[model samples]
Target: MGIYGALSSAVTGLRAQAHSLENISGNIANSQTVGYKRMETSFIDLIPDAPLKSQVPGAVLAQSRATNNLQGDIQTSANETYIALNSTGFFVVEPKVGQSDGNSVFAGSNYFTRRGDFEIDKDGLLVNGAGYYLKGLPIDPGTGNISGSVPEVIKLSNAFLPANATTTINYQANLPQLPKTAAYNSTVYNSELLKIDDFVGGSTTASVTGGDVLVGTNPALAPAGPLTAGTSMTIEVNGAPVVFDFYNGGTYSGSGVGIDLSGGKVLDDVLAEMQTGLRNFGGGAAASATVGLNGAGNLEITLGSDYYGTFEVSGAAGVDMGIATGTASSEPTRPDLTTISADKADAFVANSVSGGAITVYASNGAPVNVQMRWAKVDSAAAGGTDMWQMFYLSDSAATGGAPAWTNIGQDYEFGSNGSLVPPGVPTATINNLTVNGVLIGDVELKHETNGVSQFADVNGTVTVSTLNQTGYGAGEFLSVAITDSGRVVATYSNGERIEMAQVVTAQFNGINSLKRLDGGVYQTTSESGEPIFDLSGSGIIGGALESSNTDISDEFTKLIITQQAYSAGTRIVSTADEMLQEALNMVR
Candidate 1:
């Protein structure tokens, strides 16, 4: 029984030394492993009952256990994927198997690990080298809800989508008012008038009876025959009217043949004819009425319903056409022309209810629809452009019929592709114009795709110029770091930081009690307490790995100790065998 006990003890010693050597080898092998921790072996003793007088007892090798308190050095790498736990924590990985509830399987009832080197799979799932999917609170794509079962793997490549394409753009500008002289006018007059009557005749000669006949017998006009009565004739004295008659058979009828005796020129019959001749000698026979000078050279005239007056002869008539004064009537006021020249169409007072539509080109020169609401009406000034208040709407189709004016308190600048230009700016051309909310014209835009570009005012025109170009290239991977909250941040060449995942850390009550599993992993057992959830980088020192705690010198020393122990155990077995052999030989 003693010999058997010695053999058993030697075997136990050899096995324990071998186990210790194996542990040391493991520590040395994984010395460079991130988050790896080294382990040590411990042993217990066993004793059997002894007799009182003999005072001897047999000792037996007992169970060997691993020391779990070792900590390892931490290492860092430039790779963002490389991570280390600052505290006790395990990465939760889910299997591909479906859950009994018919949902996707997660780490809730699955496995855990310390490996954090992960990448996104083709399906945009985050996964590890073993194809195990990392688990996290699931996120809803639409509502961003994070309450469902965690996905197996997170896909990194498909993390971002393209930005929304610009559908429409609005442009507005005031048009220079046209000059006032360009206006047209309208005035007219009557061409013709209506006439009353028409007549054509001359005085007649007839025998006078109880009617007077005026005649003159001068050598210029002598009556070759008997005078006649009822002879109506036009007198030349002051262009007046007169009546005369001649008696038959040379009879002189005083009543019928009477002439003006005021000039002492009278003739009955021939005498009257002679006076008539004298009176009508100087001036020609009158047609209608005439104004002339009398023989006395005094202004003489006939005042009667059918007679007209005559004026004395003069060199020329000086007539004063009355000075006609026009009444001061009000004239419709014309809008200020000079000031209007500088005013843009947008500056006009807009009474239109429906905002106008303006089509503007985007940075890519694509036409975009924009709705412009009336902004303001500013008068033109020297060295300053007339300002107009303009607004835009997000949804033109919904609010186009009646666009509401945006509050002025909000500041607004032309969008990235837009620009403003004053009047007479040669480089800057008017892109669009609106009047009373009416879109009058369109503006052309110039743009560039690369670099930071801005529109600048150049001589009242807009010109797009390059500003700067920094970090404007395809994105590249950059450094990464873990936060105390366990968040993994991956930085990019574009100065963008992405939150990769929350490093999960797990804590077990008795880490030494954990069962070593394949793949440098550990499994939970009844002795090992349940894993307590925590985050990596958190100061909590639970189940987290402290890298390979193996010091090079310490590991080498342990290796020597293990070899010596193995040799000693073998020697003990050899000595026991030799001793037994000797006893057996003596018996023989």
Candidate 2:
């Protein structure tokens, strides 16, 4: 019984050592495999019933232990789709079972794996080198939220992305406090401002305008003021020139700069005298055309309706006010108060500076330029703070009465502080913004808290701070990428990045109890319980891969120990056989 016990124990030792050797070899072989977990051998003792005084060593059996909890080195990969897990979880995956009707059929079975060397296969499915397809939940495009509880094989399509109409535009800008439009003359007052009549169209009572800041009687108006004892000014009425001299003293001397004074009399001095001097021009409407100050203390000239010719004002002094400089041309009877024609795009453009432009798509993917222009209609000088109207080209080829520019229909007004007047409306929506007859649909313009303002800019131009529109023309699929959050985003030719799917991962209550399958995947075992699904994208690192947990040096050391144990087991068996043979010889 003793010899038999020795032999049995030695045999079991040999078998157990062989099992250990097998596991060591497997670990060494898979040392370079990505995401491979090393298998370790655990020996269990099988004790036979014996008296306490005659107890002996037990027989052993070797079982495989999972190193699934061990971490591996994370290495960065050039592949955009490669992913690695830094924590305790496995990527849920599936395999193609067969092809049916030109489409590969998937086996609905869910497998879990740490292998993340995934690449887009020809079928547009993300598959690892070992042939398992990645699974994930679909993400809602509108809400950008994960959609489903059940994970499915993620399939990407290279189809063209449809055009999105311009919806919301984030806009930020600073409008010049004083816009120098084309009609503005350095010589004529308030010429840089948008004439209210120009946009609204119609000036039954033709008039020339000045600003509200200065009093007509104040000889110290803009351009150059605080007049000298003698200063000369000339004005035209119906193509005829009327000259006058200014005098600050009560008595006018013939020692003045220009002519036409009575009784050595300057009719009631100041600007009123200049107006009286112009009345002698003998115009058909000369008597009716009155040059006077308006209620706001701003100089205004009512060009009577009977006047058929042009009017010009020039001065050797600053008598032209802050309106013009040097030589000048005749101002229009009104401010070209007619609606601008499409052919007059150049003229309108000269009058209005660029508000910036963006390309927006229509319902059918037609693209059009949303050209914006800031046309200042009134200023502080015209009895109000700066006011502007935004216009976009309605049609480039519009003719006759057909409109050219479509007003955004909001009069953006600014305070003297250069900010929008409060009750601050930071956002405005252009309902069905149409350009060149292409409907861009309703678009919200977001200024985002004092985003639009008027500041005194020397350049006198609209400065755009931020401009972006949520719209894109039809685009072809370019490529796909996985983010750290486990979202698969697809990029298109039109510069749109759309989330395609969210990768789903699963964790286990007993990870080591998972049964290893072919191609580096694991199946659920009874000991492993049900897989707990994880969708938080924990420990997922994109653009990298996890190396195998099998350490070569550790496996080599175990291999040496297993070889020694196997040799010792053989020696024990040989000694047991020798003792049995010697006993048999004695019996003989």
Candidate 3:
């Protein structure tokens, strides 16, 4: 029994050493394989039951252990689909079960793998070098969000992306404080600009009862009694405010200045004073204004050709001038350059100043050049608001056919701070907007709070900081790439980049306990808990690959040790056989 047990122990030793050698050989063979884990053989001694003083010799059993958790060296690759895991996780994948109609059919069972040499196959399926298909959640094109929770073999669409109509446009820009345009009326009135005296049925300067009638009337100019000599009157013009000092009437102050009423004092006297005050308010020499009566018996004050702004009149606590009572009236009509006719529109564009332009896509995928021109219609004096109108031309041929600028019909008003004052919703809608004969329905312009503004820029230039429209023309599939965060993005020839899908990853608590499959893939086992899906993990690296964890030098060292142990096991078997033969001879 003792000889037989020794022979049995020697045989077990030989088997255990053979297992170790097998593991070492496997490790060495897969040294260059991507995502290959090294297998280590563990030996355990089996002891037989015996008395306290005596012990029985034991054989060794070899158990193969997987070093799956060990990280591999990462190397960058030019292939966009090649990905590497820097942390403890594996890419969820699926293997093809069968082929149907020349297409690979998935078995539906999820597998985990570190191999990520994925490339888009003919069927648009992301297949790795190991013949495993990558699984992930598809991203919705409209919402740009992950659509499904259950992972499936990620398939890309090579179909052409349809065109999108221009729905909403986010625009941000600054309009010049004083916009230069041909339509801006530098002169308030083309003819005799005047201030009328309805009290006297004539103008203060013109003894003749003709000209544009001043709307308001003043009291009869009678001889004054003993009164205070120091009284003041204020008139606001184009935002510039000026004060005029008035003395005891019949005659006021400034004997030789243009405001002097040394002659027969009438409405003309007050008109002269207002004109002089306004001229001085704007630095006098360069500034000029005329005051007289109009055909309607109204007081009219017209600014010079270069000075187009507002005006207001008010008196001090004790002033007696009838002119200083209420707010002044602006110009009758504001000038507009946009005409309904095409030829006139072209002329307007040729003569008028242009602010900025942008290329927006039409509904039919045609590029439309939208030229924006800011036309100063009237200043604060002209219309009680510093007003400007922006016009757009969608007609491709502005010179050939009737090139007309479609009026948005909204005046962009500016506050004193150079910021935009929303007239209503601060949005503009273009109805039936046709560019190059393509009817691109109603395009909404989003010009909320900060979308558009007007400030005093020395350069007098309008800058469009941001101008993006939610629209795109039809595009052809160009290429596909993966992001570090595991998002698969597809680019198109029409300058459209869409997120196609997101690569799914899984981590297990007992990763080494998972059942190993062919080609470095693992199947979920009872010992290995269910796959825990992770989307935003920091392990995935795109355009790179993970090298095998097996080290050739270390595997070769183990191989040498395994060879020596195997040889020793053989020697033990031979010794056991020789001893058994001797025992048999003694029996003989």
Candidate 2 TM-score, true structure as reference? 0.70
Give per-residue CA lDDT, model 3, range 43-150, as digits (tens). Answer: 899988888667886777889998889988999999988899998899999988989999788778899999999999999999999999999999998888888799
Error of model 1, residue 392, in angstroms: 11
Candidate number with the higher lDDT (2 or 3): 2
Per-residue lDDT over 1-588 for candidate 1, one digit per residue giving the tens place of the 0 to 100 score:
567778777887888788788878888897776445577776655555566664433433434454444545555544345445554555666656655664445444546655555555545455655556655543343343343443334334423322222222222232222111111111100001000010112212111111112223242232322223323222323333343332234444553324332322222234335344434442221222222223432212221111112211111110010111221111111121111111222222222112345443333333345543433222121111233233444333333223222222221222224323312122212234333343424332212222111233322221223211111123366545544455555566545555665555567888778776544456788998787765333652322224555688998998998899899999989989998898889977
> Considering every candidate listed, which one attains the maximal lDDT?
2
- The lowest-lDDT stretch of 10 consecutive residues in candidate 3 is 190-199
Candidate 1 global lDDT: 0.40
The most accurate candidate by TM-score is 3
Q: What TM-score, computed on C-alpha atoms, does each candidate reach?
A: 0.43, 0.70, 0.76
Model 3 residue 520 CA deviation in Å: 2.1
**Which tens-of-lDDT digit does each residue in 476-517 have in candidate 2?**
999999988899999999899999899999998998999999
Of candidates 3 and 1, the better by lDDT: 3
Which portions of model 2 show Cα errors greater than 4 Å?
1-3, 45-57, 174-192, 201-348, 376-383, 398-402, 414-423, 449-465, 579-588
Q: Candidate 2 — worst ten consecutive residues by lDDT sum?
A: 259-268
